[model samples]
Target: MWACKNEGEDARLYQAVKACSEFAISLGINIPTGKDSLSMKQKYKDGEVIAPGTVIISAAGHCDDITAVVEPVLRKSGGAIYYINLSGDRYKLGGSSFAQILNKVGTETPDILDAGQFKTTFNTLQELIKAGKVQAGHDIGSGGLITTLLELCFADRNLGASLDLSALGDQDIIETLFAENIGIVFQADASAEAILKANGVVYHQIGTVNETAQLTVKNASGNWSFDIDHLRDVWFKTSYLLDEKQSGPVKAKERFDNYKNHVLNYSFPLNFDGKKPVIDAAKPRPKAAVLREKGSNSERELANAMYLAGFDVKDVHMTDLISGRETLEDIQFIGAVGGFSNSDVLGSAKGWAGAFLYNEKAKQALTNFFKREDTLSVGVCNGCQLFVELGLINEDHEEKPKMLHNDSAKHESIFTSLTIQENNSVMLSTLAGSTLGVWVSHGEGKFHLPYAEDQYHIVSKYAYETYPANPNGSDYNTAMISDQTGRHLVMMPHIERSLFQWHWANYPEGRKDEVSPWMEAFVNAREWIEKLAK
Candidate 1:
């Protein structure tokens, strides 16, 4: 809140506060949190500069189920666009972006004339959302009705809309399309219309999602066509210009040039239902260890994933191994969780590797664990660096592989895809030929492979072989690799982070699955150990 000085000609600051209070009271909303600088009027050498007061509101609503929340992305087929004006006010352009651009501020401005109606509309929409009716949704804001319609088509690939602004009445063409009003434009199928009408919700069937990538806008004036791709690129240009300033010209353009070309494409295993398998409580749970150093933060997530996969997960810190407090004797599976171990001061997992390479007890425990025929290990992010540094995964190679800084020389954090190849890894063998989305976040995740690709048991490759999708640009586009025995593995992607349905960047609709396919890895590990024990 930039509350200007109250010593103005008409006490503008006091009036703003009064207006805000009245609106909130009418809406039954509280102004519980806000900070203000009421003394922003600066006194110059000659005169004073009375800055205009500005107040912006940040509203948050609680979600019962985040997965059920409606998205703003349009589906390819089976949806009709609808609009309901919640603002109960006349179309107004005063103080709007259009008016400001033209330097013409009219007397009246757009607002929610009926707060009760607005709330009713919101609650009605929530009911529709809970009923799985809302396909896509976007609010009408500054740039007005037409702009909001265009934005809904921009998010998805090859999506377009055939718009008909006729139902809004024979109002002025400019006012009907560009006037800023408080409303929402949503996409839903025919079944939702009865529920909306039963509640006496005022709505208009505006358009439908088209197959070809083109926006057909029809008004009383004329019919107009727009290229969605061209508009999307134009929309992204402003952000790209700012990115160029921070990330430099080359990298920014490389990102801008390829950001929209690659949408996430995934292929699941033939029988991989996204449901948590029912575990028999009477059976013994498998034992697994989640190893961590001081700065590690991902152990809890990894441990939770293992526990859910019918394993008794233990958090084993480096201190425990160094002090000989916890040996790998009872542990069947070990996971080196991802994080900045030792704050990654020396490099990614350099300090972590030193503890095992130099310390006798820690080194012996790890060596003995690797030697055990019953044990299995997998490393992620910094842990991947640790395994490479210690030459644990590639013991056969005299010149061991290394983990290096990403080709971008920046920390890459992305929810991306990994195509699991045909591999004999005990944990990943069943998941072969499956393309899954997982989280990848690390700076030095790039694999500097010294040996031939055929020599290593390459388990996974990235779905997209370019900058952000490939993330670290590992050799041969490798996202993960396993030892020849398939007993041990190292990868940059975090399967633990992507265990649930909400973890994915874009998931298939109507799934209602409790877990994502990434949970298969942990389940596979647990089952493998269980079978071996039998």
Candidate 2:
């Protein structure tokens, strides 16, 4: 998709489109969709402001294998870092980030000299990724090669590299370091070297990884070293400043201080094999109802996960229950999906909960289901809010758990780590003592517990107890909760969204299975229901 914002300049717009069309024709590809906003000039009494003509290209494509993809992080055990310049040795500084910072735009600009070579290099990198040969990969863009090398170090823990750019044999050291040359830099092993050689793609082994979190460079001018941590903090300071405006100073400071300290350290179950155990086909799959409200969006994901875990899934919209079209009579399991139910304008799940409380049929149906001995239920995000509002988990207690606004004062949409604590939750008990990554996207997700910690069945807690990682400032870093009986569960994060390994932001290396460990939760629920049925 192409999105253009341009001043009233038809000739410039035509030229831009013509250039793109010519490039697409050369590549034998077609951009079938686009949008344009020609009105970009603002007339002022003093002076007129004309926005620069821009065309943003957005393309979506399928990858060969998501599991094989490498992050732009310099690993601790990283080998040599190599560079494959697609700019064909033309290190143009014009229209580059370096020029922008220097308050100058030079005459000549960087361009894709050879499209065929570019395609070959792209495909070669993809092949190396799929073959599990490349440990890390980064593109030399924006800030050029120096920035790329430093960024790789910035992403990982205590990782740095020494790169000698003297091999480039460029007369100008500034051009060699700062020029906007279209290129690829990667950390690879010996096996990758063999394949890279076979591909006949010109690549230079430029650097070696080091344990010290500092970057060292060697060029024609001289040797230079930089403290990676200090530079990273300098880069992050801007982010913290920006965050302070939105997340509040206190929350932003908390995040800034704790982000590096609170690393994602996972611990899996001793018995988790990452393989699905075969279940008997003779028995009928247990019925599970995926509950959703007006603005709910994660219902289909919940339903699919349930189906994968040996349950016959059914979609149950709030309207169905409210109108008495479908009662919670047949469904053994209930999965309340995560989303902004009723647009969350009513504050969290107040509007959603009101629909059930005001309507006799919906209220009675839900009440009956919870009251039943054989039924199991799980609510997530907005659904979690609704469940707390209705006092479903601790209906007996006068002061029930309350869902409040996040500590950040905004919706916390993050993929963070959670550790499964020892609990009797029918769906999640099997995964106790395990730490996993889950998606959290919500505004009012914090749990305000008036009672003692032991009173509520806490199933999972955020691995990090600080801001951002904890996402919502829930009591005791509580990520998930269950009832006294362990039949009903509620969580702020979306486990259904993290059903597959590919869904994870950063999965454990060497685990090749399609299904992630979170799938065990649904499986356990299915097994529990089957045993109860028997």
Candidate 3:
């Protein structure tokens, strides 16, 4: 008969009471309740007079409520009263509804048990509780099962119980050790044999309660047990701080400093010359005319390779170039790196296009330069979208093509296999008869191209194919698509990231022969540009 101010609080009270009742019923203990106050009082007095081992589980509701009512009656009856106050941190069960909240935050499924298995296990447990055979049941809960088991052994005065965990099909040992569930408790001296006979319940008799305050477990292989007092001393009080003191603080600080320096100063090998050598050129390298944006790791790597292949690179921001201070005639190859530009809002590529279009002077310069084919403008990932939005590729309408959200409705960064289309376009011509493996990390990367009925037929003139094919659910399985002229290529995937063997799929052991083809593609593109320059 617990009263609460609101329905939510009432629900919590009901759950607490129901859990206590279930635990009592499993132990073959009965509690009396009645509408009349006198009858309830008489039942309490009789139970107290009987001198049975009674435990009253109550939530802290109104400071002196339990002390005023049940405390006196239990004291007179010569029984001990245990009060359980429900005021502490509350963690959601691993298999409960609250687990979905973690999925939204991390975008990864955390539960080891699938929905079907969880439902099956829950249903079986419910049915077993309904029958009178199960004398006591405990929910596997916080600090997980290990802590719960230790607490149980402590409470029962060093009584150990055998647990058969074999019924948990195909689950990892670590997962079982830390799984959580609320409203569950372990019951001592329950009808273990009858409980096992029930449908879908599998358990093992592993060990028993002892008088010496020790816990022991006997699995199929062997027996291993520990004294509770010794375990507490070793686990609770043992400290690693003493060892740290022996090592000395100055030595630790020096070691940590060295580690940080090693990480920051590390440089990868650019050439396969057997010996790792620092890339320091004697004379000043010729600088490329094009203004390059501050590149990411991938962009920087590609730019370095371009420098090796004889191209001048000047890193500049978009704002600096749009001020009319940077001229296009001086630049041979204008390169933009692959990254989430302008936060990838209003669809990918759209933002970059808007920035370029809104700038009157920059737009005029780009239009004049692009028409002459003197400047080779390249964009990657969101940068690719920028090229599309600016009408670098000939489009029927002024509106830019759209890149939609991934069909999976989640962001998945992974490597996929890709086959090149052998169209006569400048981009694909270099990639003909070759396949590539590239890394992709993007949410909105679906590419759409306009097609006409009579002018460019769907099957023949229009090239629409998906592949390392259609990772982001693009309309035509398009990993990369080019404009009609084939001079400007816009691709959503990041080829620069996959430049090294470490970035390749199944490197070292698997696909050992698969060197990143995108590196060669860039070099080849550079060679083509060099030829065009001549």
Candidate 4:
């Protein structure tokens, strides 16, 4: 959001917001909430200057597991690479970051074609992710294809890639590499070529992931090569402090080797091998409540998932419970839906949790509800943060083991992979040792459990204890944990987001029609509730 005093600029801002809303609607997505400030000006000794009018769009949606998400990094030498053209128009360099850096602005803004084209491209890409056809993925933006490729190469310091822009047709090297266009670049096996072709997706196979320490791009004119280490040093400008050996060839190579051998080779897969029994929704089901707060955004999807899993679901709000409009007495299970309740005031979920703590009636109701032996509860994302705040996860409400800022020091939204523990909590008991891809987006998500030596049952952990895989840098790479009784589960990842196979970024091949493994958690809760009720 930006402020502008001029009416003309405000009109333009409204037009831009309208365009963005239409674009989102075209793609079947929604913009739930937004913020705006109308006046922004600075007065100096000479005069007052009105700030540039701008409309910032925050696009957020649920995605399948982060485990299967395509990172910008190149992985597996020899993997085929592709360039997907999303903009059905000519390449233009106007307003590009590259042009701005060079102090040159062009006359033409790159044309964004019909929304239908992007919709098709995105759908195809989603299928590819679900099928595990894409190993790495990146959108073409910023410095255009060139910078995107560089980011990929730098994503994993040990990896490099080689490509030929000749497949992009008779475009100039500058236009081909620097044009800020709507497109995507991804890496996959050769089999993906047939998949794209069969789906009528417009794409060009342009390169391969390689072991060489360089970014090699070839055009009709000739071949160009950039030394990986030098590029990193120049681009990062502080490699001396971050990776001190960037200037040394032998030391860099040694470090790359260690990263490849130790980190790159680590692998874990889904456990069932396509043999797990389908959830029998026809069987007797238990009643459940999907709790929500004023700012709770995930209740609909979670309630839908529960209903689909054969639970008689009710959408309950905090006001409903406190005002005697709703009761949990009839509910055998509860899903604490995730969201930025009360705009994450006082910290993540703190305001939402305070409702339970400060309201005597609601507090007594929840206490009596929790005492029921036949009940089980699951909290996700913001709900998980609330659980920690309310001492649901930690019975004694220890000062440690609190939800804190992610080590990355910023909000992170990405698909991440996690490994289910062998002796995981009850919600994930059937998925022990399985690797899952789940989406996670949060600012203060890190689980700071300083005393987590063996107190809580850890359900899932990051496959790789790194930036995005272990997004929040939780203690022991913990993604999900449970209370001592195993009846209460709190997890940071959005498992409910992947209840449907189509919602996944990648699902096992031939399992496209099946529901995701995440549904198991809900079904398990239902089963537990039924048995305890008996």
Candidate 5:
């Protein structure tokens, strides 16, 4: 095992040796020890090579850096080195610093998954395997538990297994789908006693393999079984097929007319005198001035433009609804505007999500409205975060969209360019074959999804600059995404504010373009609403 000492090296080196010694003792390996050099000499004298078949754990710089040095040495001696890399003190696993990273990653800090714990586990597994203790090993990675189990089944090939997952800490289906912990692996051996004796880390035997090709899972309550072949088939199928069923060629004129009627005929009740309720005529009314709040200038402007294109607009505080004053279904369109709401506590948009989720009436109302296809919703910036939290969109599966932190680890407020993908979406059809310029301002805005086979698709994306350039590290460079139904549009940037000429970011570029392409998309939406009124 190769070790190095840099600044503050001696203490770390001593800790590493102590851990290795404990691991060795756990495996029932006896080693003569005294000073550091004395122990090294004793190991060499006891028929152990100083270079190979030895597990070298270090925190010298990059884990890969140490691996490069140790691999050759181990190979030359006809052995392998298992390198365990530590990012920081193992005890700091669930501290606030780690929680902040999780917040940035747009995921709740997992209670059971810890990086340091997994690193220790990996090192132990490797040591056990090297000592001829385990027959096979598997690493835990993306797709969380589901992917891990599937890979294990593939590796075993023809050998089925039953898992008693009662010992696992997390039981939530969604949590099991996306939890990511590095360096953890599962291994098995023929001789259970020998494997136990060689164990250098903590592990539990959940179950054993059998002759069948079925993967059976047993919880505290009962058993569930699935065929590996069937699982693999479903797992590999493309998700794009969900939108494969064509709605036939869309009659842009006819559909627009229908949308206009749908909006105009939709009756909305309003409490105008602050007491008595009255029915408001649903018509292609001019977009009303939006009530101002922090970061709402853009949304208000967009709503006003939509009014110009002909649509009713209103501004209601999210908190006002919580007072049992009005229901979401009462409104024709719910505009979730941008800005840091509730101080972005418990994760961005978490407060809004919590409010919605806890309100049974509101949840059912939104669900029924969508089921009836009567309501249109738009989420921008912080609003986008709320949509994911409320589960209004991205409901194809149990997975929820997570808005990860920016790669720069800072809030970037600037104007970026985006392009719309041509697809069979009512929303995307308006912006087909066109590029859009919009303003983006947020920290936790990066998007990530599990690496599942055919589970998701990127409908539209932002260009790096004005062409195909990507500014943020968004998945597929996605600036805007929609659900399969195309009823909900969630965008990270603020298009509403970019409606006016003065708000254009390229104003100083000497560009002759007055209104941004994004404003055009909003215009298209208004035109669609107008046609619906007819």
Candidate 6:
């Protein structure tokens, strides 16, 4: 594992880094690789901009087989959901996103009761997973149980869950249900109860997955049943509603109500034309280029996923191409990883796109790379934004699509659901018709497609019965798209994040023993690359 920290020069930043180092030391963690960009200040003629001192910590780890990993998706209806406590009687809402939503800021900082207890809890959970005891798991954070529990339910559209908070000894219902605390919730098989008890972990039987399509919680006040669909719309409301007008377009309650029953399947024919792949005995793997720019962050994980998918991975930096330090001459696959390149100025990835457009060397190299029929490209999040802006994603159209500010006024981060579409891009060909859970944390993610719908292939769409399942309120709930040729694909979600099961703090019970579906994206890309290589 490797850790990197970037801190703006300030007393707070210095102290925070010290505390972080102490925590890392306690965990026996080492910072082997890292980068730092200091002095985040800009001065204009009249006024100067001094941004808040901040520290961004990035970490990466080596996993033998991502296919053995789990994902946070609510599984079989009738599965048991357990909430495991790690903070020992501490459920603080200080600095919580939920508090900000309610226009309330509390002074108490959320704390870990004991680092030892946390380590024990985490290790025990891993033990259960290793023993095939845990079906799925998710750690509680941010908006608290309300967010966590709902996310579990949303993992599968077919689930309706019921929770009885009565087991949670006398406490303020609001605080108990909405406090941001250190804890994890997971589903397990009935037989795992023995192991859970032997482990001596603090836990509670909070809920049961059902088919009612409702979220029922029994509290001291009484039994409360919320229409799951309506709750979803409110849970994912586009904006912090000062009123209805800013709420944007919310799907009808009926849509949410029947979403669980809606069978979403597409039968569009695939149009891939290529000769059979011939893997040379001497060189079995094709070279895959994982591209990154200054602010690019997801490169490590994206590259990791591709490497796991059987590619000869190459780290490609935009600066290298622009300075003629490196070339994509032999690369078969090109991936633009996500990040706030150029600090998302003039819109997300706009600055990154400008570099490709203005730098003659970089531009020509990329053009030549894309012109190769065997070469394929995929862009994610900020990378997706840049591809659309540069006409890589929708070259077939005169007026291409654009990623715009989400109807949500601010950045919304969550593990959301999406379903693959038929006749999609080569990268998703094998994932068609499958539903998945992927992380989406972006402010400017909504898609503005000006061309006719048929001009491009829709790779996937949000499983939104209401507001947030659609996340960004994109047109047609579109989450990803490809160029007319299907070789170039771009998407908003972090598919690489779901490469392993543990990547999900809470995973689907039914899929607990299975690998994440997102791996198919890379698998499909590899297969495509191999075919073109022939």
lDDT of each: 0.86, 0.86, 0.47, 0.76, 0.52, 0.73
Model 3: lDDT equals: 0.47
**Residues 420-493, candidate 2, lDDT per residue (tens digit)?**
99999998998899999889899999999998998888999999888879988999899999998999999999
Greater-TM-score candidate between 1 and 4: 1
**Per-residue accuracy of model 1 over 1-534 as CA lDDT, tens digit each:** 443434562477668788889878877888998877667667779997766567888888788988876777788765899998888887988878888889887878887787777777788899999988888898999788878877888877788989898888877878877888989999987898998888878899998888777999887777888899999899899988987776678777887888888688878888977788789999999899999998987888889888988998888999999999988889999999899999999998999999998889999999999999988898988888888889999898999989998877778888888899999898899999998889999989988898788988899999988877887878999999998899898999998888888877788766777998888888888998999998
TM for every model, in the order presented, reads: 0.93, 0.93, 0.44, 0.65, 0.43, 0.60
Superposition error at 443 for model 5 (Å): 0.6
What is the Cα-based lDDT of residue 331 in candidate 4? 86
Instruction: Order the numbered candidates by TM-score, best leading.
Output: 2, 1, 4, 6, 3, 5
Per-residue error for 84 in candidate 5, Å, reads 67
User: Candidate 6 on 370-453: residue-level lDDT in tens?
Assistant: 888888899999889988888887676778788898875556577767788886588787768767667888888998987666
Candidate 6 clash figure, as a count: 12
lDDT per residue (tens digit) for residues 70-149 in model 4? 66777764368899878877889888886898998788877667888788778888887888878788898888989888
Tell me the TM-score of model 2.
Answer: 0.93
The candidate maximizing TM-score is: 2
Name the weakest run of 10 consecutive residues (lDDT summed) in model 2.
1-10
Query: By TM-score, is 1 or 3 better?
Result: 1
Task: Please list the Cα RMSD from the true structure of every candidate, rounded to 1 decimal place.
Answer: 2.4, 2.7, 24.3, 8.4, 24.7, 10.1
Model 5's alpha-carbon lDDT is: 0.52
Rank by lDDT (best first)? 2, 1, 4, 6, 5, 3
Model 4 TM-score is 0.65
Q: Which regions of candidate 6 deviate over 4 angstroms? A: 1-282, 504-508, 512-514
* lDDT per residue as tens, model 5, 463-492: 542211343467767777777766567878
Model 3 lDDT per residue over 264-343, tens place = 11112233222222224663333443333333224675576456445667765667658877656566555566666666
